[model samples]
Target: MAWRPTLIFTIFSTILTQSLAKGKSDSPICGILRTLPNATSNYSEKYCILFYKTISHLAGDEDSTLYLPVSDALEWDVCDETEPPPASLDIENRYIFVSSENNCSALERASRIQSLGGAGTLIVKEKLHAPKQNNTDYNFTLAFIQNSSYVKIMDGGENVTVGLYSPEDSLLPLSLVIIWFLAVFSVGVGAFWSGKVRHKLYLSEQCGHVGEDNPMTCREPALPHEETSMNLSAKSIIGFVVLMCTMLLSLYFFYHILVFVIIGMFCIASGSAVFCCLQPLISRIPCATCRTPYFNIYVVRGTLEVRQILLLIFSFGLSIVWVVMRKEPWAWILQDILGIAFSINVLRVLRLPSLKICTILLCGLVIYDIFFVFITPFITSDGKSIMVEVAKGGTSQEQLPMVLKVPNFAFLEISNICHITDNYNLLGFGDILIPGLLVSFVHSFDLQIGTPCHLYYLVNVIGYGTGLVVTFIALWLLNGAQPALLYLVPFTLIPTYIVAAIRGEVVAMWHGDSDKFESGESDMDSPEEGVPNGSAQIVT
Candidate 1:
């Protein structure tokens, strides 16, 4: 929130901006320079003008025209007299085709606007090109001059553009840097704080309707019907579909070893959850009194405990180690982090009808994120900075942007300086799918299988939706979309996280055994009951 140097630059740029909204704003730069307001202030502000140059902001836009005045007093109207020849005579000697007219006799014939008393100024018109293909302009600024005195006479004749314009110098690059920082930094920090506050409330909760000793006495369960049987819930069907999808994703691995590893992890998660889900049902069914040791099916949920979950997370670090050990660039390693983080964040919040719905959505998000990174839609560089190619039409072919190759992985340049974090790739449909499914597994998990937090069923849903909407809005704003949506709409799904959290406080209530207050017994079965006196059971 504190004012910074970027803010200072914006204020300074705003001072120089001048615009005549009645003229070029309507007619564009091709027509005559119409009458205007104070051209200095109006144009300066209307078009972002700044003195400071940084790679962080230099990546140009598709249609931006950069006017670099070689000397302040040079006439912008006639590059024929004002704009100098190549800085080095050797530039023209060594490179035969340095000038735009060097190879085009027709173009040289067309540059004869002098016969009509109209002087032409060189203008470079840039178009999108892959990095190593047709990119000609590569200098820091176009080597050209502008003249105003002869501008009015140049409208009627064919003119040659003598300027070198690079696509790297685009329109209003990072125009509202300060504004974006103020907005996103404020909202990101604010939302993060809000999440913390809600988490605190969830952690420090107290029992309400459900008594610690007996939940049965506190009115009938809200979904007692759901508690009656396993009943092949919609969630189970979803699991099957997701599992199939997971198997398919396993095929995407460049190496078969990676496939086994990923699939093995998935199976571990599913196997553990399934085992836990069925424990209560099996416990309730009567078995003939046979002293067969094999019939004793004792369910163990400890391996999937919270600490164990944390351990599982730590295990993922091994992959990072392997990647680093392979001597990959830091960016690629970071892409992994980013890809996982982005996918998880999105999946944690999307909504679906059933637990299975979550599986599909999460898988979709993951696949989309990863695939996009691999084949991201930007040009790549071949170990050369693109700022020195002003030798004119005979320069090397330009490659695609944002597709630079690295030692092993790719850099995935989202922009010149700002990229897709340390470990992620481009946004693609399949990348969205796989990760979406994995995240869905987390969202769709039925905690009611054993834990005292069935309220998460609703709370997690709301949280999932809210988190998703928030993430999308954040991404949209980051990608130069309108930033006001987050304020205008409140995500109702966020309530789910809150509700699930409050349920956490009442955990003791749901986990304990039926008591005198719960079962309406004057005295409940004491420690001397057939089953363990106080352990809670999952009937569904």
Candidate 2:
């Protein structure tokens, strides 16, 4: 119904408005300096003022105020308290440049510029420092610029002009929307696919009734060894967290050399992931079902279907192509596709058997994420987050392929303010895969219980989406890098627990009885009891 879409839109609008209202009211103003061609400089350059603070009266508007530079040559001593403005200097209606090294306070600098009839004052400093004293006495618009910008202006002579403006935050970046959709799609499809595979394996384990025409019905189940997923234990979760910490530190210290190694690993892993994701679909094709002769390789021997071989070649070829063309503008499409496939494959292969293990894993990772992203900045020399720096490529030309990147499609020029030149929003694979394990486990639990409509699965998936929205909201309001798992784990885990408790399956779900399939098999053996003879029940 049309009302469904309308209701969703209404909810989204409400959330957006509420989130925006919570954003920082004292957002910093940005400035752009444009240098015109002069005798010494042939080409023009535009520099962004990264560090700046605007006066109280100039805080409301988003419009840029353009000001031409004064023609007077600025000397370090010009703004000194001992030296007043030169007799010949004319600063009327022009923005005057004042360096912090002039041994004068910001208020004093602004007052001197105001007395000289200047339109505004630009104070250049190495870093931003709020005035210890009140700045209300001087009314002219005052802002700070980086020392580098000041040097450039001095070199550019009087041909430099600046435009100051406060950037308006986008209601929501389209990149975030796309990333959310991709995350939901990846987790949902991966869970469903995992459940289907689990169901098939469960059915294959059963000893069906023997038929005279087909004795193979009594044969032992021949499940593929490679399809066996690793069930995470409590200790393994802790170990996984430790390993993640080690890897992050390694990447931070040795990023230049290790990035290529990680790229190679991603190529192999993503290729295999693609093959795993596509093999099932391709197996259904009649023409592609041809099998190759069994071949022995050292201790292993197996026959591969024609489709499998073709998919292997195609998947690896695609991965190699992405590595070669990753710098291209359109390459994010391929990267996202491969990344989603990789996440789905990981969710399918790593089984969190119970709610207990899921809780342990999710909580451990949430702490890990928080420590690296939020805590390490205070400890590091450069005062940058280790996690954020590693994720941002850490001075390397190659970025880790373990994230889903969506190019920002917003019309606003907010990328410069955020210090992101590529204008891409990234969601780490851990954010999707860790919580996705819980989602997948719940789907399997739903299948085990034969819950009508998969209520647990549905609720957990919706919780995950809600958590992602909260993460984005926090990111927008704080205007900083966020630990997504801080929001994701609680949202996904708590809802599933609540649903389990309400359904009175809390104990069962917490332990996740693995023998349920065996019990179901035993029940299937007695055909006259209810189940049809020799008929297999497949959970869809």
Candidate 3:
């Protein structure tokens, strides 16, 4: 066991000595890391050291460099080892292996290269999601080059010089950790508080008395029973088909137009939310004898307050600034504020009353995610994983407005070399919104039954947090892009269902029944109808 590392060091040392005779003191050639016709020219270097920039395997600045002349390996089906690449005594040559196959794992290819006496191996994966490499106890250095750089290296043969910049550090940024916790807590609080407020509003609407002066104080409103309707008429089906076609064509021809349209919608929604929040304060301002309050001029969807109008103006100003300046940091902050508002509103309005509905929807999505991400490649000759390609390409050039990037607090100070580097974590809204919906449903369920302290909401939120933690662990452990919903859907769904079953409420919950009130009721003042003493009975 001890001899293994020693043997590797010896081999590396031998390669370095051989490369030194052909080497110079100059730095490696600089080329932009991309693949395209206009990509930077590649430069050949007699000596180079491979660098690993991942979170777990960070090669330090002071690590020893092994100099070897780069050489290209002949293209072969690495999956079928029956015809392995011919072995050579040229241990001084670092090999580059390119493959588009799905059968062979990256580690397997690396191990095979080491057996063939490669000083180091560079794998150029054609697919978007590369195979995971868990075992680092290899005999030689290895690096995974992605996208355009791979093409440049392949075309340049031994002449391409590639460089990888070291990240701030291997440790997760403290600000990132703080932001993540705050996001989860805020989503939870938003969902719970909004649901409770909505419940109270529904109570007020159903019963006429809204003020403290009302006499019937003890009376509680009937639990809401939403109507579930399915209108699959021919006209509806035709309308759906037309809408889809229009969307596809619009996205194809006018992608930027769609982007601006979405921005406009976000402005309107954010403005309305700001107005709703400030309405009560705006109403208190006294107006002159016959004239209306100044805030009345601002009203659009409702009696919009002056501050709310200002919020809309500010939002529009920020959008304009982002377009003109292209200041990425500002765009990041503006997107974050808008994204949070969208999430809260979605959680507030979207309701899944039946337990059966939540389970079926989430479970179906889990299978959908796994199939597209992991299994589709084998079934079809698709060049890349659909989900991986979408996620990678969607964020940058296409500029798909699918995610909100949290601002890295560490980057606030302007310094050449600050230890507190910005660690902006870009998370897709679907990752937050989907689970938020389920967690919101559970909290609303708690409200419906008059449960104290939102017990079920806490459990389901814990399940969501656990699932997300496990998803990250799997990403590191697997060393590839994973469908997050593959882990999340099950973790959130199963535990909450178990909790419901244990309390003997699964049957009633599955059918969207409430135990505190009868199946049908119109008024809260009936002697038979009112708030429960404590927790309601768990109806089977």
Stronger candidate by lDDT (1 vs 2): 2
Best by lDDT: 2
Superior by TM-score: candidate 1 or candidate 3: 3
lDDT of 2 by residue, 443-526 (tens): 888887898899888998999999999998888768677888889889999888888888899888877633443244333222
TM-score of 3: 0.55
In angstroms, the error of model 1 at 375 is 7.9
Q: Which candidate is the best by TM-score?
A: 2
lDDT of each: 0.26, 0.66, 0.48
lDDT of 2 at 90: 61
Q: For each candidate, give its TM-score against the true structure.
A: 0.23, 0.72, 0.55
> Which ten contiguous residues of candidate 2 have the minimum total lDDT?
12-21
> lDDT tens digits, residues 413-468, model 1?
22322222222222221222222322232223333133344343333334434443
Give the Cα error of residue 36 in candidate 3, in Å. 32
Ranking by lDDT: 2, 3, 1
